[model samples]
Target: MSTPVQLYIYDLSNGLAGQLSLMLTGRQIDGIWHTSIVVFGKEIFYGQGIMITQPGKSHHGSPLRIVDMGETAIDEDTFNEYLSAMREQYTADKYHPLEFNCNSFTNDCMGFLTGGSIPPYVTSLPSDFLSTSFGQALQPQIDALFTGRPPSGAPARITPSAATPDPALAASILQSVTAQATMGGPGPSNGILSMPPAPPVAPAPVPPAPSLPAPDASLVSPMHITTNPASFHNLLSSHRAVVAFFTSATCAPCRMIEPVFGELAKSKSKPDGGVGFAQIDLSVGLGGALAAEYQVHVTPTFLFFLDGSKTHELKGVNAPELRTQVDLLIYEAFPPHAHMSLSLSALEAIPLDPILFSQIPNLDTMFTKLAGFIDGVTAWNGAVTQAQVKQTLTRTVLPFLKASTATSPAQPPMASFDHWPTLTSSLIANLQLSELFPLVDIWRIALLNASFSAWNATKKVQEGPLNRFMDKALQAGDVPRNYLLTVLRMLANAFSNQVLAREVILFTRERVTKLLVDALLHDDVTVKNAAASLGFNIAAYLQKQRIDKVKARDDSQSAEENEEWETEIIVAILNAVERETNSEVTVHRLVACLGLLLRLSPYTAQVTSLLEALDAQRVLKGKLEKGGCREGGVGKKDVRRLILEVADKLCPDMAMAM
Candidate 1:
């Protein structure tokens, strides 16, 4: 009656349809076909519909089947309501829009029409019934199902539009949502429900890598000095103790003791953590005169300054004793609170100003009359027993000596002299004494062959009253040639007086000339080498004076005598230079000798003889070409310049010859 509703069903894949056939037939599906459109093995359904038969005549082979029911047509409003209810259910299940087959729609439509009951005609429906034209036209309905709001107060749909959201506005909204979520509130938007997932964001940029820590200053001693000397005074005025070093790179002893002093500087305690260490390199012209004023003959030397004044000295350091001495000096400068009584006693014994006292302190009187004892030792002379000497030195000098020795860790063990002769001789000459002349002469000769241990035993005595007793020891004729030369060497360096240096030079020149001439003929290599080296230094010293014109004129010595002395000294130096075997010493002596001859001697005969000897040896020419006179006659141009200058002054006519 209602144009017989056609139904079509389609299987997308053959395997799925076979599975459906087994479910429908209650028989295991095998490969078999029943109808062209509903093949038995291929066409499969699970009781989806039924076929109904009616009273009719067959036109061909089988009877026609019909399925009819009363009032099968549905009204538009009711259909709309039914579609809305169906969409609402699907929406709640998160189903999206999709095309539907005719069979499926018809089945649903039949169910709604029959109030959810299936009819007998459903069994007659073919598997291909859903592929008919009616199924293809349902795309609009499928799309609308997802696009519009559903019935029963369902939420409205959110469609994706062509217009893109503003990135800034979207970011702001996201930030607000994140903040709310962090605070335990409902999120700002419901994008978490149906929104497309956003691409992951990279983490925020990391800060720059941390830098390495600086080095620790506490581990090593720090050298400190103000640009102004007054600043040192200012620092000392406020601090209890300030340590200072007078050092020189040229001083071997100073180089050795630097580390020990550095350690002491780091370890020493400061009452208010205000103590400091300062250093001055006398070799660099910072404080040579100041060093001399403090009688700092040898380095490395340290002076302990307390309250802007020098309180103690540490001198002549070697390695093994450095740490102990440093500890002592630091303790002396800044003692622990409990040791103040002992420290005061020790302080009282040490003269507030040692330079003001002519003599060193004595053990017995040191405690009660320290200044008077110091003054008494300046002029007093008693024949001290060896034990007494040892005791006095241990008490008075050992502390400072120990401190100085502690500053250098690399120094060799102290060389001992068995007797006091050698050290005493040196001390006598250094003191420039004439009263102890006889004793000085005897000791000088005895020291030449004395053992080192014997010599060390006498060091304290020699450095004491005897130091002032033999001022003229260098002038004593009974003194051995080697010993006199040695004494002269000590005197030349120890005293700052130019007059004393000149006297030492005169004495050394006379004795060294005799030794050199004798050593030249001697077969002993050691003796010859010693003479050569000695001659080199003496010649170098004289040459420096001649070049600088530092010598004072003497009216007593005639011009002829002076000329003869100069000629003799030059001849001796040239002989040593020719005979010397050690290349280093030979070269040094040769240059010094040549420089002296070029500056001082006016005798043309002596000059020609010296030049002939140098030329025969080829020493000067070889040195110029090979060594280049930057040091020790290496550079030809410099040598030629010096030669020409000397020639011009000595023999103007022989300038071209040089």
Candidate 2:
């Protein structure tokens, strides 16, 4: 019962005993060998990250000796889970004859499974031997040998599991690695260092595969940090929270919390999850730099970081304390944006994070090309290049557009609004109307994701092109639908910035929204639909500002006027919907806009007037009676239900009467 774990070691290239010490250092150290960790259950789960074979099954006969890692409280399923993850991290492709080979696998496995390390001679032998002059001298040949065709003994390349393995989390295995392979135990007081296994006396018996457990449903599983200290910083990405557990070999409390820490890590690193977990053993080399920098004087010290900077620290094995801090840290990494009572939830809100430069390999190239197009003296052939510009805009801008604009937890390009001024200014200065129309779509997208200050930065420059574009449209007999669409979209997104929205509204005596609404009667269905969308965004923004002002109660007169203003805008919106009901191109978006208007809770008179003036009851009732908003009921979800719910919210009395 106590001996739940077994290690099988195989020696290659004769007994290591013959030449190990004689040519210990450098080039001469590359030793030929293999090892595997097997949990003694009803059926042993074969491990072949490096070809797990039984004692005498391999060409190398029985292992020199078997080491028991001790009894584990981990259940069969969780134990298997850890093994599966290890199988992912330690693969045949990663094998190095002198550095990380089969013995490294056994050491890591045993450490994770039992919090007990393998014999020093085993884990450290390759490193110690490699440092010797002989190891240095012979490393080239050894490297070439292992790199080409894996020796007949090595494990084959494993196909990684489709389900992403939780690297940060841990399962049943308790890993304990030390600078020296010395694990404090009664067995192997000195070293079980062996010469190449006595020339294949007999093959060991092959073990049966384990009845492995199904994968964990948790978002992300446990993590173990086995890489060098130099690479530790790169392991965690920006805009994420990481918890580092600095434990010394002597810490009892550290061992007790290992399982808890591992489990907590799993919960925090799930998909869309923001936290990371790392375990560091101070007894190992270079552990001092990390420990000293963080002043980690105590074992089991938990350091919490937000975007790589340490924000909180907890010492000792207080599970509750650690859990609370981790939760706080995660919230900090991906905090919810500030919202009024009407703000959308994570599921509902539109994402507005900018297309980050880091994510796109050709980001600079794209930026340069766009800038050149805008700055060029030549007028683009409207028909020829419109489609191309639209494609470019969609690619660059769509990433930034979300259902709602976020203020904080500021992270990434969305949070880095400081960079927008230079970018926006160039577009405003050089972009001609031909290219500018296409650019407006993404500019609106950018506004949806931008904070107030970010949007404010380019307002002045934007006004010039927009004004010139609008004047040109007003002078035309045949209105360019794209131009009108651009105007409306910009107005809608500008609402995110109250000051900018107000300036725009006041710029032409509030003609922008009204012009868009007026365009609902345009012959082109696309223009009509664009009008509806623009009306919705503008009305939604203005109504919210009015309500917020009323909520603050500056003056009752102003409050009443705000209500009247909201009613007027809603009436305009509802009127556009009424006129454009026959337009197939925009009715869906228009209907959705009405739903948003109702959600904004415009004045009661507006809803009633909308109903009365538009004879909406007949049209909407018929639509509702038919079971959905779409024709032929091809819709995936019930849009009619949503429209009714929003309508009912706006006018319960009217809804009940209908």
Candidate 3:
């Protein structure tokens, strides 16, 4: 085993000194030292010290004297036991070596070092020597022992560095030695020293006590309430005005009112010292039962009590109203000498009526006029910019409708297309006399009319508006799904505004994609159509963009460029055709999108799982088509000519092959 390191000690406390004495001597001190040992409690503190031994003097009349061991372990059980014994055996009146030399010496030394008084020694000691002398002489020996190796055997004392004894310094030396021995000793005893047992330990500290809750003023008097229900009735009987506000954590409105209630409680005083406020959070245990008893359906219910009796109940109070109600309650309970009237005209300055749609009767007329304008542009083979359309819808259509509906008692014209004509007639008649008509609606009307003028020329005047009206009516949400589907089919067949047509198709596709993705796991046929529509539109758009890009490129390019361009063109056309006819396309829309990309741009084949999809549609379609009646087939000659025509329109380079 390694030699024990020496420890130096200084600045000894009386308790530490007594503890050290008990630890070293295996004996209890009496009176002062014993008291000191108990007073200092334990050695769980950090500090510094030195040790030295005197060559020719006895330490505290002990045959063997030891000094400090600067940083060394100690036998904790032996030390604790010894100190405990000293405390138990020593009396307050008797002065013995244990008390005088151990206890008094420890006390006085500590007092000198720590600037505190030495406690009186209660233990009897031998008559000639002063307590101070023993400490002073022992100091050097204590420092020396700590400076050198610690003692090897059980309860053995070792002196490290030798010092000449001065009577004045002897007391300090002895105290220092005691402190060192207590603080720095051999490791905790391994049952070697037989000493008295230690007392039972005190219980551990509990967590911090809960704080008292603040008073709540939202509850009305007469209602008995307490977070502790057993005491609730007692509290209510004592109070004249009692108010209970039931609240919860999740309620936003409840949280908002908490601070306001707290403020009210602080500002108001109880009349006859009988008013009381209580608030209960419904989130805690047993809160649900209490809530049920109070019939608290919603949060922040303020129940009022008058003279410990239930009075009025208020629900959902705003801050200002709550303050006013509380003030009124207070005034009623404790009336003032003067009465003051309050005027609320200033508070009522802002309008509070909700705007309803039926009030705007001309709204449908406005929409019709706008739709008419759109029709005119479509007829004229003209394009109406998105900005112009959105502006017309917001400024003209929405406002007119709001106004017309605002004046009517009947259900708003928006409910169905039946009232749209009445709304449209009013708008046209109003517009006919106004100059704003030419600047706004006319310009848009001219654009759309020009776009579709040739197609609608043979059609009658009333036919245009009637058709548009029918289309809008069909698209109305109140219409049955099958009827809406029929209308959509009719619109597709009748209209030739390819841009609008394409956009409508895209919109349908996106909606279908969402529905299909949500219900795909169910294996529904409706889901399949939706997925197919989405895939078809995506492939169509890809083909369109590819063709547009190709057509825009200059024809004065190299052969290699032309070949690459041809390949791209071929790929795009093939993808569109395949996507239109392929039943296997009924998978995830994203997968279908990836497949379209891969077919159009096969060079990206390294991207695995890009074209993978769960397609059961091919098998289903085969079964369906097999069961359908066979139709008349076109001759090869006519088919070849049709193919050639399609090739010429799409890829001129591939026309020869067809």
lDDT score for candidate 1 against the true structure: 0.37
Off by over 4 Å in 1: 1-384, 388-497, 507-509, 516-537, 540-561, 602-658
In candidate 3, what residue range of length 10 has the lowest lDDT sum?
43-52
- Candidate 1 vs candidate 2: the TM-score winner is 2
lDDT of each residue in 1-658, candidate 3, tens digit only: 1112211122233344354434432344321222221122222111111111222111211222123212213244533443333332222212222212233323322322232322222212211112233333333333343333233311123222223222223234343434433332222232212222222222222222222122222211112113324234444554566667777768889888977876666456352345656665565323455577767788888877676666677788588877767766655554431111222222122122211111112445645655555444422222434345546556544543353334352323222223223333433333322222322222123213223323333334233332432333333244333322222223322223444334333333333233323323223433333433433344444434443443343224321122333333333323333333223323223223333333323233322221112121222122223221122222234322323322222122322323
How displaced is residue 152 in candidate 2, in Å? 99
- Can you give the TM-score per candidate against the true fold? 0.25, 0.33, 0.19
Per residue, candidate 2 scores C-alpha lDDT tens digits across 312-417 of 8898889988888887776556543112233333212322221111111233454445556654746543332534443544443433442233334223444444
Question: Between prediction 1 and prediction 3, which has the larger TM-score?
Answer: 1
Better of 2 and 3 by lDDT: 2
Worst 10 residues of 2 by lDDT: 171-180
- lDDT of each structure? 0.37, 0.49, 0.35
Give a tens-digit lDDT track for model 1, residues 1-658. Answer: 2212222222222233245334333333321111101111111111111111121110111212223423334454554454443332222222221211222233444433432322323322221222222212222222343334355322222221112122222222222222211121122232122222222222222222222123222322223422123334444664666777777657777767777666666555342324667665554322455566667776677777766778777777754555555455555565432223232221122221101101222323322332232233444344543345444434533343233234362443335433344334333433223233333332332222223214323345333322333233324355344443333333222222333334434444454455456554345544444444444444445444443432322224322224566666656555554444335434443444455444443354665655554452243333444333334443334434433333333323433346
